[model samples]
Target: MSFRSILHDMKEELGSISRKGFDVKLGHGFRSKSQRVVQDNFVVIDAFKQSCWANMPPELLRDVLMRIETSESTWPPRRNVVACAGVCRSWRETTKEIVKTPELSGKLTFPISVKQPGSRDTLIQCYIKRHRGSQTYYLFLGLSSASYDDGKFLLAAKKCRRPTCTDYIISMNPEYVSKGSSAYIGKLRSNFLGTKFTIYDTQPSNAGAKMTRSRSTRLVGSKQIAPRAPAGNYHVAHIAYELNVLGSRGPRKMQCVMDTIPASAIEPGGLAPTQTEFVNNNVDSFPSISFFRSKSIRVDNCQSEAIPIRKEGMLCLRNKAPRWHEQLQCWCLNFNGRVTVASVKNFQLVASREDGSEHESVILQFGKVGKDVFTMDYQYPISAFQAFAICLSSFDTKIACE
Candidate 1:
């Protein structure tokens, strides 16, 4: 019999039973066997009724599903597209086509947790893409869960207008700004045509709302290179962080080597030039000297008296040498701190050693704690602000963004 005939017969049987008043009740208000059988038949008929949509034309069905997916107004739409794909074979194929379009997939989402105004100890994830035609790069920084698009926007950075400009204005997402506050965080300024740059914290002070260069941390090549040379001409052999200080003679330098050379830039049958070459060429440059405050006091008579003092410890950024990962197919940076290897995504920071062995202890850890939030842990000597800045830097294209 036709589907319509079966459906009609089932409806007629249900109506006839209702009109007959054949309400047979079992013990404790349970339905009688006859009622149960009728209910089961209804369920079977309903299942067939639901299957009618399965015969819909592929194009029409896909259009309906696409509407449902796009109707979600939030970043990382709440309706799980991947889950929808699992419903049937046709849906899976259609989902693949829908997601491949750049309009749907190019953007990323991250959940953000902002504890207070100007808080730096927050976890952020950055997505970076380089546009070769424009010779520029774009960064989408956010907090997200499961690497899905349900990300909350935090900050964004783009190259300045000038073609030779290496400066990028790192701005706060307007949606995150309060009524009276400005959306400016700071600027990433490069010195030698992307060879070196400083992260200038331009956050306004709470009391005066004045824009001050609160803290400046520098990232530079380990060996000095001429300012005029194209940055890509030489691999980013070594990258260092120059810690910001207060009333100090100069910033302290902590350096690490990086295999930042792209495979395309590698010369055939030869390694990149050694650091020794740059050292030899710049020997005439004068190095700044630092002066330490005297801790000892001079006695009234003439003798010098030594004072009992607590030892001051230095804070450093320590990590193991970044290694290439076959699965990730990108270099991995593992730190010797609270962060576990699993929490790290995209890349990490590993400590370099003189003896050429990896360091097992981590000095700082920036790990995800929630869908839109991350935690920062660091030992003394590294302020929360400095650690936060370092984490933010991770979201940019290390070589090009500099």
Candidate 2:
């Protein structure tokens, strides 16, 4: 055969092999230009697309998501539910519906911490919603005045390693006001276990600047009592504690007192006692008489037996009474303070009935609201100063004391 005819035959053979999907190598083991171009241009489009959860049937998808969203014990779901909403339109709508439910949307709960602005001053700010129907209450805890020269002072408890055994100081500013006078009002000290702590009346007497051993008031934890279901979503039953006034004489000496009356309990003819009146009545009930007592001497019908103090001076209540609120036309609990903006410690004031029913009307909750801030909600019957002081007591752990 001629050279041209041989070349033509070779070309035909190569073309036949190329059509069979075999890679043809040219000089230097490189693939043929035509074969390379054809391979580059050929795209493999998958007939089976990636599977997605969004394609799931609406009913089945909702069931699967409900398990995750409701898994959290908190009132409003926090993690997976919120994250799933951003993934798709269907997820967003489902999450919105779930969160809008009456139980979840009615209350607000948040975390809070204490911040000290100065060595003698502490500041706290938080938001609180009193009840389903009431407006949000803003709580602020700081110095009444920024001036340092004033001998009178309000302070936050300093962070203590041994909170139970050590005395927490709420010192007066300037250390010394008049000639040879020490600046100290009172100190709060807890039991060895921290289950109970007392605020002492340390203000110096007329004789001289001396620390008085007189106990102003005490708060005792109820860890030994039977646990009830939490009244609100963020709260557990463990936070229950009792407020006790120190007494001198008999079994009824120490009184379990509440400063604020529920708005429901106030009758048209009944008197609504002032916060000062309430405090004075409890304080005067103590055997020791002082000039601070008001001459009027108003009595409140809302006094309970002192929760018996243990051998260690720790008092725990067997039961708590709900306050009546005539305005809201329901039983309510007022967590507000007469002298302080918030309680010195964190506490819960639950509105429960005398019949021991499961229905809770209004829960006045005080707790950590945010970083360096605590929350107080409910009708504030007492002064902000007193409420702030009560909240200060709750900053440390009662169980661990650390």
Candidate 3:
């Protein structure tokens, strides 16, 4: 059946379900006011449980959802897949299972996909727009030139400057960009000289992830009405720029230690931790993923402290050394024309072998397309969060590295 027909059928079923009569007064014998309210909630829940959509067979539902997912591959149509997930809990679980991780499909179907890694075979092209006046940066999922028209919003970060270091508060919510916001996911912090940087995720990156001493309760709303999981900054990666002793002419050398990912992940049949769900305690409140098209503003200011880096058998990445162009008299690496201008921020990252050799295939590349605009393309074994944090490190002014 066509997508329009499927949508019409779904709407009709939902409308009929909503119109089903339920006698709320049947629970009038409760002793206390709160007890009566709870009983009423149960009744409503029971009514929803009896809905035809909720009672559909798991196998049939899975097949139908899979068909919808396969047919609608791109946006306005892709929204149908998301709509299917929002039908009910059973449908949501089935849809989630059908949708592949971005590491394999290169599609951002859900919000959690941002936390997951990119595709292994193809580079997911994205771009970042920097608002200098506000010190906030927005990350989008496509290479649209006209204000994110052909693009989808992915993540946003607000730069907070301090005396000793800098912190970029990353959040899925574009409107409220802060550590306290429910959308807050991770952050990128720099050291005093801007040479050393740390990437932190609110949720654990791996199964054996250790808890840091800086854990805090995630506030729900502006009034802090409800509390959820502890939104702590778990160390995920570390980035450091080598000081340029020759000075003024050499390219910036950088290295990244992926604490959560092992060096073996780049090998065949290797695995890395993938986050299937979000950090929120209740999944019901986050049933569907929605994209916002507005600019984000800073909501809170939080201080940063030194967190010791602990690395053992972890994956290491370094800049793919650029060749000296005798004709242009400048360093150059092929960005596949994704990059237009030559800037010191332009660099490609590749995994370092155990024997100290770098891989030929570029895993991530960030380069300038225009003033305050840069293209960020990343592939598997590293998430958009990690890649964006690593790119943010390049924005820090490294006087010593220069």
> Evaluated with TM-score, which candidate comes out highest?
3
Write down the TM-score of every candidate. 0.30, 0.29, 0.82
The 10 consecutive residues of candidate 3 with the worst lDDT sum are 26-35
Question: Per-model C-alpha lDDT, please?
Answer: 0.34, 0.32, 0.77
lDDT head-to-head 1 vs 2, winner: 1
lDDT string for model 3 (1-402, tens) is 776797788778666655664322211111111112236446534544656777888998988898998988766677788777776668777888899999888888888888898999999888999999999999988744443344777899999886667888898887888876767888898877788888888788777886453324323342222343333457888888887867768789998989899888888888888998765444243323222222221212133344333356788889999999999999999998889989999999999887788888899999998888889999989999899999999998987898
Candidate 2 regions exceeding 4 Å error are 1-155, 159-166, 171-187, 199-347, 351-364, 400-402
Candidate 2 TM-score versus the reference? 0.29
The predicted structure with the larger TM-score, 2 or 3, is 3
Q: Which stretches of candidate 1 lie over 4 Å from their true place?
A: 1-145, 161-165, 174-181, 204-314, 323-347, 350-402
Tens digits of lDDT, candidate 2, 1-402: 533353354456555655666554442111122232334658642211111434557896677566655554242334344445543456556655554321223211111011111111111223322221221122333222321112111333342334225344443332321111222333444454444444433321112222322212221232211122111111001122432334322111111123223333322342222211101112222233342434232111011112233212111112224454678654333443322232234445433333434223222345443334445433322222233334444554544322
lDDT of 3: 0.77
Give per-residue CA lDDT, model 1, range 275-364, as digits (tens).
Answer: 110111131232322222233311111111121111122111334345668897755454333233343322233333334453444434
> How many pairs of residues collide in each model?
16, 44, 0
User: Which structure is stronger by TM-score: 1 or 3?
Assistant: 3
Best model number under lDDT = 3
